[model samples]
Target chain A: MSQLKYALYTGCTARESTPELLSSTLAVAKKLGIELVLLDEASCCGASHLQDFDEFLAYVLNARNICYAEKHGLTMVTICNTCQINTAMTKHKLDHDAELRARVNEKLAEVGLEYKGTSEVKHFLYALVDDYGLEAISDKVTTPLSKYNIAPFYGCHNIRPSELQNESNGGENPYVPTSLDRLIEALEGNSVDYESKNKCCGFHVDLQAPETSNRLTGTALVDAIDNNADMVVTPCPLCHLNMDVKQHHAAKTMGRDVELPILHMPQMVGLALGCTEAELGLKHHVTKVAL
Target chain B: MSRKETHKKVTVKAFRFNAETDYLPYYKQYELEVGADDLVLDLLNQIKWEHDGSFSYRRSCRHGICGACGIKVNGKPVLACKQNAMELLELFNNELVFEPQSKKRAMKDMIIDKKDFWDKHEAVQPFVVADIEEHPEHETAMSIAQVENILDADYCIQCGSCHYACPALEVNEDYLGPAALTAAYRFTVDPRDEAGMERLELTAQMGSGVWDCVKCFECAQACPKEINPIEKITKLHNLQFEQKVARSNVATRHAEGFVHSIKKHGILDEGHLVAYSERAAVVKHIPEALAMFKKGKIVMPWNMPKSKNLDEIQKLVEISQTNKL
Candidate 1:
């Protein structure tokens, strides 16, 4: 096995809104012998909201985060899909456009920081499946979840718009992705095939149009339930919040009696690795998981 | 030559509605034995030609161009000519649900009124305004990098996928949809165009402008040409800031508050964000903020814990702000 080290960037959601995801990710990475060096000085990734308002600020903020990882001589790893895409998109833009790169670097020079474009931004899912191959992961599974039917939801940002994807980062086929499903199979679980598997959880519109969000969320959950999935595991914290926390709201809005448990990808891996429910934050989920 | 040997039976559920005849819009299923290489457009054409002449859909070029055949296949915006029927069948378990783009008034089967879409497009003035002194013979040379910047924006086919998938448009019809705003950005950055600032001014309005986008990214996904309209819109926002156009909107204030809170606390202070972003209207949100506090969604700014690395974050923020253009 190669020596693994990463400057872990826990975005606003994992750091503030859902610390359980952060804890479980740390616990799982440790178990897998991957070193996660925390970049405590990092601020928000300027999120999707900030990008809408000021794209330059978003680029500058993300470049700052990337600069932190480059300074430490480690690649950046993000647990949140939004953070991964924002940082990766900024990296792609800066790398391709020299003028933008020069401008961003000029701003960074004031802070004694420079992005040499050395570090790579990767989602935790890509790291687990690509860096730590499925075969290596299967070898470490002592508590194989043979009975559980898991629905692997690859939320939109993590995979789509193939321009952001690369070979090492799951090299996702934006239309039909199966890397998440493959990871679930490695954990000795059934990856339930269902409609709306690649659908949006509608987390973005939650504040503006709650009903639209609910309908979108409800459709995915209903599909998972119809296919008899024990739980829906996702790589995105926002998706987990919508599918797990606001599921009952979605169900009420859609007038359905659906109850499907949602798990962060790391939590599912931790559970199959014999980690306790409490340690994995299984108890924190609104939709109860029996395991 | 046998019917069973060449094609597989695929179920297509197409949206059917005629306002003059039907009271409500509904789906009508059709089972067609489609060839392996057949596109979704081919399937639609086959149905309309052989199976049912009454089935209505818009299509000019059988290929991916023209952009006239945009529809929702399994609730995702896609061009019918670009999507392979067999691949879609396998993905959707041999069943496909086709709907005319949502948020548009359905005219008939798989056809929706694009008048509003065209109106939004026209609002952006999607054309370059040439300088009167510049003659056609005196062509201005552009760098390779300059062309690459506007390349993606030029790939838009006016398919209405981005427009239909936009959450902002669903909420506020006035919001300039992704495609039009992308067009606005394309011309704004074009070296040959003389009306860059004018274009920015037109798109910087409070309601139906660049700031209205919610940044959902559905437009990027829905775009069959991979134009990534959201990225183009991001560039437009950057241009708006650089031009100092519409600097005092809630969106701009929200961004300022977001950065300020992050620098001060190393994490987002939601209370500060709402208060600062809302400005004088902060008083109006007092009841809402109290309700949120009661619900445990937020902590008061004074009571919030300072992040461990607030000092370092503040330095970075200070440098970035001081060096801002």
Candidate 2:
């Protein structure tokens, strides 16, 4: 397998709240012979919050982060769906709008930075599936997880709004996303088909309307459990937090007793690659991965 | 090979409902033999004409115009006229699940009551309201750029597909949905219109305005005409901030808090974001915050261990602000 290097932008959630995600991601990448260079100096991708406030600030902040990856001559990969979508959308906007690019570059010049739009923003799953082919990943799996039945939860932002779709993997079908399923299969796990597989995990609205968020999260979890998924795995930290950390609250709010283990995508891959639960940070999860 | 031999079988699972007869909605699956070149609308037409005459649905200009054949194909909002039947068969594994546009009251099979959608659109006053006296020639004198802006907004077919696909409207019925807000943005940016501030205020009214959107981007995907409603909503947010509109809304607070936190620490500090954005509401959640802190879900003084590139980020923000003016 050829070596792959990427400037990994671990968004705020992974940096502060989900440290295990970062550790697992690093461990999995190293095991697969992929070099994930951390963009330590990079700030937040200015998420949707920044975009809602000031479009220019959001553009500038993302452009600056892209510039850091470009400086290292590497494409940027993000674990958090919010960061992936935000940075990818910004890059798309800058790429299509030269006038905006010129304006962004003018601001960037003040900080001795310039986004030439050379670097592309990719989700970590996209990197794993597309950059590192499925065959390569399957070959590296030392502990085949054939006994496990995993349901892949693709959070909303990673593949929607049309423009931010990952082009490398048949783009995003929204209704029937196979990227996560392919990854699960590569780990020798059965990708269980379930209703509400593509539904939003309600991570975005968790703050504004907790009840509504819980209801949405509860619906998907219930569907997964009913379909007999051993556990759920997601490519996003926010989704992991919602499906794992908040599962108890969601179940309580919905008047049900639902305990479903949720794993970040890297952690699942780490486990299948023979990494211990501690090494994969599975113990940090609120819902225990009994398997 | 003969054309008959090339045909394929497809199963359509459609939602069936009747306000007069049915007590509850249910799904009815229909099997059909369709040609490769057939559109979903054609398949529906064949089903009604050849298989089941009682199976009712709506369709008009079947060439992707008119926007009449909007329905969910396998849980995705798409124009039946625009979707190739063979491709959909391949995509959904020879079976398609159809339902009337979601978040809408179904009158019958594949038809929804769109009165709520029209009412929301009218709430925004989606018309060019000129401050000056109205004249026929005045409308004709718009520049090419001004005409383009009006045309972009006019692209909406009132299909309600976007309205149905929206998660916000699913939860909050009164939310000024993607289609309505896109129309609101249309009038707001019209060069000849004088109701820019008025329309913005209308959308900002009630808690379900532009701010209510979770930025899910489903509406943009649902639109068959490629009209990006979420982008329009974001532009409306920009207009709200640029015009110095209402400051008390949670959306405004969140935006302001997000920008302030990023400028200060070069990253988002959730504690600061909640404190700054929620203000007094933050006090109400002291117990929750403490619990999170105990569980190590959050770090207090969230803006600690500041970014090394803080100075550079500040410079970028400062320069961008001046450029904005």
* Candidate that scores best on TM-score: 2
Model 2 CAPRI rating: medium
lDDT by residue for model 2 over A209-233, one digit each (tens)?
6666787788889888888989999
lDDT against the true structure, per candidate, is: 0.78, 0.80
| lDDT digits (tens) for residues B47-151 of candidate 2 | 789878888888988777787789888888889898777777777777788888862488988888888888998999989887665565545466787776554
Candidate 2 chain B TM? 0.91
TM-score for the first chain in candidate 1 comes to: 0.97
Model 1 error, position B192 (Å): 9.0
iRMSD, all candidates: 4.1, 2.2
TM-score of each: 0.79, 0.94
Number of the top candidate by lDDT? 2
| Model 1 lDDT tens row, B90-209 | 776677888888725888878888887899888777898885564566757899989987968988889999899876677567878899999988888888898888878878776677
Tell me the DockQ of each model, to 2 decimals: 0.25, 0.56
